[model samples]
Target chain A: MNSFLTAFFAGTSQGAIYALVSLGLVLVWRGAGVVNFAQMGQAMFTTYIASQLIQNEYSYWSAFVIALISGALLGALVDLGIMRPLSSRKNSLLLNSQSMRTTIPVIASLGILGVLKALAGIFWAGEERGFPAPVPTTGLRLGNTDLAITGFDLFVIGVVFLTLVLTTIFFTRTGMGLAMRASALNPEVTRLSGIRVGSVRTLSWAISGTASSLAGLLVTPKTNLSPNTLDLLLIVGFTAAVVGGLTSLAGSVLGGFILGYVIAFVNVYSAPENVFLAILIFLLLALFLRPQGILGSKEVRRV
Target chain B: MLKVSNLVTEFASIKALNDISFQAKPGRITTVIGANGAGKSTLLRTISGLERPTSGSITWFDEELTDKSVEAIVRSGVAQVPEGHAVISQLSVAENIELGGLFRKRQARGDLEIATKDVYELFPILFERRREPAGSLSGGERQMLAISRALVARPKLLLLDEPSLGLAPLISAQIISIVDELCKSTGLTVLLVEQNANTALAVADHGILLALGKVVADLPAKELIADSALRAAYLGY
Candidate 1:
């Protein structure tokens, strides 16, 4: 139980980070019917921006706020500049629009990764950059051994949890949230209901971007900084979503933590060469069993 | 009053509406009864701005309504209950009603909430099942919810596509009774599209018949219902 508690605490913090990314994934997928494969790239770029600001001696709140705003703006930009136009083409099937929207984001994300890599160099020599811890580096002592949970981890957990709670309330309680839900089910019906379907879709993108940025910024300090940070983090995040089920928020978060623990456990037991096996196992599980994950519900294809 | 002149529409190679023309008067119900491919849905979709007519003008109260978007048309006081029970499936019954009032920027919540309570008072079963998912609702229940959603918007002009599409006679009568009750209120215009010719004419003050996207007959509801030739040719009575 002691070992379990320690492992739980460690992975839960990491899961919170995954929860942030998963939340974004769920929002975009639910609202727009697209599987956003490049969520990590978006997050990686935002994380780079946060690190740059913090290293320049900007206030912590200012840095986080900048990242959040940029994240949301990027989300809206993607919808307005890319997805919305494709959707407006009257006869585009739902699947085609979804694929088109998702593919553009993937390509754009790859481009963004390259641009960020170059920008990171221009701004501060584009080299492997270091991250400033959002919180002070002090591990809580538990029975005199280093429990390895830092203040930053706690802050990440707390912020991510709050965001999820607030979002759940917004979706269930507010008028906008209800409209957003309606927009998800049927865009044409929502339009007939007198709601602007495009606006709701754009709002989803903005939200997805902001949440992804939050994930990137929170985890940046705990890991090495590079263009691929978000790219790698995204694979874990997507694994969490896939393992938990694509459209389930709760499943994504739970998947994130579950994946985190598996990886962390494997890192302790198996040689680094065999670590890729754990990820392969996660992907396989998503393909075979519980693909809709613990928190997710599966949608059937009409034959 | 509503007037549609030379309204033409196409879906790729097929012409959905071929120079369609008709009129619907205020304080009365106009019925458009037709076969499946007779352009009933297309006419309404064009008039309501969901589909753009290839050519011609749709004027409502002397206002040009051709080529406007769905939102613009709705904001201009035209509301529609779409075909095939287009109720937002994941939304709650109450939220469905709430959407009707979303356009009323000036109205306070007091009357609207009371109106919601009134819908519940009128349909107790719906109120009882208000918290449940709209998807799980019966066919008649979904129809009731869709019409109630439209009624909540408090539109001067209401367009209902197949209000009695799929339901038992009993449930159909219940919803039609609610729509009929609205007739007592002055200045309310409705364009009800249905295949149930008897019911459509029974509740309507005036009825218009469409065949092959053209107005085949336009007369008082009772007069058209009484016309055996028109009934057999278009109404399918």
Candidate 2:
């Protein structure tokens, strides 16, 4: 029972990290109508920036802030420099009749992933490095048993929850946030209504970048960091996003927690080596049951 | 007043708006009536800056609007209520309406409230259901929401594309009458694009007939309506 409790705590902690990364993916999906496969690359790169700053004796918060800003800039640059051109090309005469609208942006995002990975390799090489937890790592005692969740784990969960709350408020209450949401739904109508959807798209990417950087920073303390440290997390996050319904932010968070618990329980009951296979089976079952995702709206076919 | 001259908008190899030229005078509704392929929507799109014209000039109150951004065009008192009553279905009807005024400097929430109240005056049904998601609104209500949203910005020139696109004849007539009343009361200039020629011309003061991206005739609404042969040939009346 204690072991089960321990796994549950461990799963929730890990799930918190997945939620952060999943939120970033969901943001990009909503804003740009493109599933950004490059999220892991962006996260890895920004975390490295944070690591370098910390190595140079900068305070953790300062390093984190700087890394986040760098991530935002990187995301904006990717959208402006790479995604925009590809999008324009997709609309060009030769490609107008082509039915690969979804695939084109995806290919562009993959190119971004490659570029970020190469950049990280060139700058920092392929060394695995440990980053110290910003908060206390000592586990909370549960009736004399050392539980898996530490103070830092609690902090991560709190931060993820806080981020979700803030983003919810942003989209629901603020003007710009509403504009971003509306633009995601229909860019043409948004532009006609006097919103500069281009700027909104760029801003959405920047927000996603900042969230990804935060996710990277939070996850690195728990695991060793390398050039491709976040690749697995990216896949998990993508799965979570899919589980939550690709278009729904709240759904993504729920998906992440569900995935986290699944992995945790699986680790307890089955061989650790079977974790990936278990997750795949679970995802397959979920998708087979509900193709649009558990929380996704029914696809409205427009006339 | 809105003036568009020699506007040529091309999509790939096809010219959607071929040397289109027309004027929308202040305090009048100019209905651009055409068949589906006649470039009526394209003409409005070009003026609203959604589609760039290959060659032409659009002036709004003596200010050149060619090559300007959509937001810039809106700031210059042009607002487009796009085809299909394009309300942001996820947003509340009020939020969708407030989005109409987003081009202006960030107004206080109180100002937004007042602007919304004015729109409510125009669309009382929307006021009752302002808190609901726009998608929940009935088709006619959606059209009302769309028009009132554009009116929230209080623009000098209103560009409405296919306002009657998907509504029933009764609902379409209701929407047009409301628009005509709003135009008469506010002295607002309107450029209405429609495939529903009879209804559009009935409300409009001036009419321009379009055929395959070119102007077939530009005349007073009454004269155009009275011309039975022109109506039979182009409008299928």
Candidate 3:
């Protein structure tokens, strides 16, 4: 029983990390209608920057703080450079046709990805690097198993929980969040209501970027120190967004944790667990029980 | 008072609105009623700054508002309750209400909450289910939310498009009555657009009827409603 509980807690912490990344993807898609395939790269870039700051004797908290703000700034820059133009051109597009506009980001990210990859390979390639142990330890004794319950794990779980709660509060209690959501559904109507859809969209990118930065900063401490760390998390984050229902914030959080924990368990037990297997399972699940995943919304086709 | 003169809005090769002219006095419900493709929605879109007039002028309280953006128009005290599908399904009920008066910061928030209380008073159903996902609401409930949000904006003019669309007759009646009561209390001007000619005319003080983007009838709402010839030609039997 102790063993099971230890494994469960350990899994929960990791699941929280997945939720963070998933939340980031969901926000980007919701506000800008882009999948942000480059999210992983952005996170990787920020994570590297944060680690560099800490390694150079900068305080971890200050490093993390600077990284977070810069990540959001980077995200806004991407929006101004890429999303703003696409949105203007696609404003009058029909509902189904809007998805076609998504190609803009996908294309733009290719060039961005190349630039990032080259920079990572040239300047940042070191022997081995990791986060400055922001959380402290990684295990607690639970019967025979060494349950990994470090301060880092706790910090991650706390951050994810806080992020989710704060997001819910903002959406509910604040007027800005409301205007953003309203603008996304129908810009013209919200505009008529006197809401500045452009400013709302920009804010969306800012918020989502913060989430992305947190995920990268947190995840990199446990995993690899490569430039592609954020990239690897992308698959999971995108999966979470798809499961959660791309438009629903709550759905993304739930989807993120589920995917994270499920994959972790599968890796533990299954003999042939691979990324391909994960994709297969998700595809099957989407076909059968589509809306149960994170951010998922049931669409009732009006007659 | 609002006066639109020589308003022209074109789409590709077609003229959605052509040299349309009308006037809506302050503190009166001036409705625009026409057939499905008579450019009523386009005219409202233009006046609200969602669409720019290609080569004309829209004067709202004696200011040229034709070329401005939607946010500017709303700042200038014109708000629109767009079609039913425009409702943001993901937001909470209270948040939905809060967004209506968001352009103006201080008094808008406090006043909007008071207005939301009034909305709940008007549509008790909305109050009862104020915490649920807005998309979960029925068509009529969505209509109530849309109009209530617009009212919170505290606009000098409200451009409401197809408020009665896809709603049950009873529900439509309830919304219209609530709108009527709010207009009375707020002394707000409105340019309501609807294809339901008879019902729209009932709530409106004056009416403008359009055909293929041209004003075919400009008279009192009751006068147009009473004209059998106009009714047979556009309003349907």
Candidate 4:
């Protein structure tokens, strides 16, 4: 029972990190209708910047900010340089078919991922370095036992929740955010409404970059930093997004928590070697049974 | 004033607009009425920069607008309400309306409030259901939301494509009257493209009849309505 409690708390804390990464995936999906597999590459690249800055004895928060900004710039560049040129309005119409529209971006993103991975290898050189935790890792004592949750864990939870709140406010309260939503829904109408859909799409990618950077910063401290350190997390993040309904923001967070606990419990009760299999089984079940996800609306009829 | 000379647009191998030329005078409703394949919507789209022309020029207020992007054209006071009553179905009615003035951020808050108030006055039901998703509105209400959204931008040239499509007669009349009122009250120029020739000519100050991607007639609204020979030959009235 004590072991169960420990796993539960640990799962929730780790789930917070996954939520941040999954939320970024969901945002980019809603904005551009593509599952950006290059997100992990972006996160890993930015985290290296933060790790390098921290190693130079800079303040942790300052390093974090710099990393986030760098990530945003990189994301914007990716959209402008790669996605825009490949998927212009004319080309999309020519492509016509829905499968072609999605497939082209997925392929482009894979190429981007390969390039980023190569760049990371050249700079970081396959080294795994430990990251300094911004907050203390001391655990809380509950009754007769020390809970596995630490101050750092609590900080991750707090930051993730705060990010979600701020994201919600930006979408609901700001005009630019509303324009972004409109652009995603119907680009032609949004263009007629005077919004530069291209610029809005670039901005959405920037925000996604910042978010992925944040997830990298939070998660790197719990594990050693490496170029491909986030590869597994990216797969998990995609799973979370699918579980939450790919289009929903809040649903991704819920998916993260659900995934976190399930993985933790599996790790505890079952052979640790079977953890990956357990997650894959859960994902397949979710996709087959509940494709729209927990909070996703039914697909509306396209006029 | 808006002028088009020798404008041509093609979609793949098809000529959607072929060497079209006309002028839309300020503060008046100029209706383009045609059959389904006559390229009425294509004309509006080319002027607004959604569809690129293969040849010729479009001048708005003596300024060349042929090469401008859709956003730039809109910022320069051209706005379009596309066919099928397009709305951001995921967003609330109020948010959809708010998007209309997205480019004019310097006056967005103040202008949005005033414009929203005006829209509510123009269509009170939209105000009552401002918080509801735009998809939930009835077809007539969605048409009203599309028009109201375009109004929020306070555009000088409003390109309305088939506002009367897919609506009952009474509701269509209400929309036309509101548009007529807007032209009179605000001095707003409108380029209305419609398949409903009879209703379109009744409200228009001037009419252009398009046939097979070319203009067949450019006459005063009264003349187009009264010319039974021309009407029978083309308009099917």
The per-candidate count of clashes, in order, stands at 6, 0, 16, 0
lDDT of 4 by residue, A1-303 (tens): 877876787788778878878888987888887789999899899998888888788998899899999999988998999888877765546566778888989988888989888998898786888887888878877798777778888898898889888888887788777887788778888999889998999998999899998889888888878878999899888899899888777888888888888888888888678878988999999989888887776433110
CA lDDT of A98 in candidate 4? 77
Candidate 4 docking DockQ: 0.62
- Please report how far candidate 1 places residue A123 from its true position, in Å: 4.5
Ranking by lDDT: 4, 2, 1, 3
Q: For candidate 1, list the clashing residue pairs, or say none.
A: A120-A126, A121-A125, A121-A126, A244-A293, A245-A292, A251-A295
- Which prediction has more favorable TM-score, 1 or 2? 2
Runs in model 3 lying further than 4 Å from the true structure: A1-9, A90-99, A122-128, A137-148, A184-188, A270-279, A291-295, A299-303, B89-93, B105-107, B136-141, B167-185, B234-237
| Candidate 1 residue-wise lDDT, B93-137, digit = tens | 777777766656355567677668767776788898987777778
Clash pairs, model 2 backbone: none
Residue-by-residue lDDT tens digits, candidate 1, A1-303: 555665666677878887778778878888887666656666666777877787788987898899999999878887797667655665656535656655765565556556656665666564566777767867777686776677877888899889889887887787788778777767787787678888998999999999998888888777777766666677777777787777666677677878778766676556546656888877896678765566555332100
lDDT of 4 by residue, B1-237 (tens): 989899999988799888899999999999998888899988889989989999999998978899999999998888899999988887789888888887886756787678879989999999999988898999999999999888988899999999989999889888998999999999999999988888878989999999999999999999998989987898676
Which ranges of candidate 4 are over 4 A from the true structure?
A: A89-100, A142-144, A298-303
User: For candidate 2, what is the lDDT?
Assistant: 0.86
Q: Give the candidate order by descending DockQ.
A: 4, 2, 3, 1
Q: Each prediction's Cα lDDT score?
A: 0.76, 0.86, 0.76, 0.87
Model 4 global lDDT (CA atoms, 0 to 1): 0.87
The total of clashing pairs for model 1 equals 6
> How many clashes show up in model 2?
0
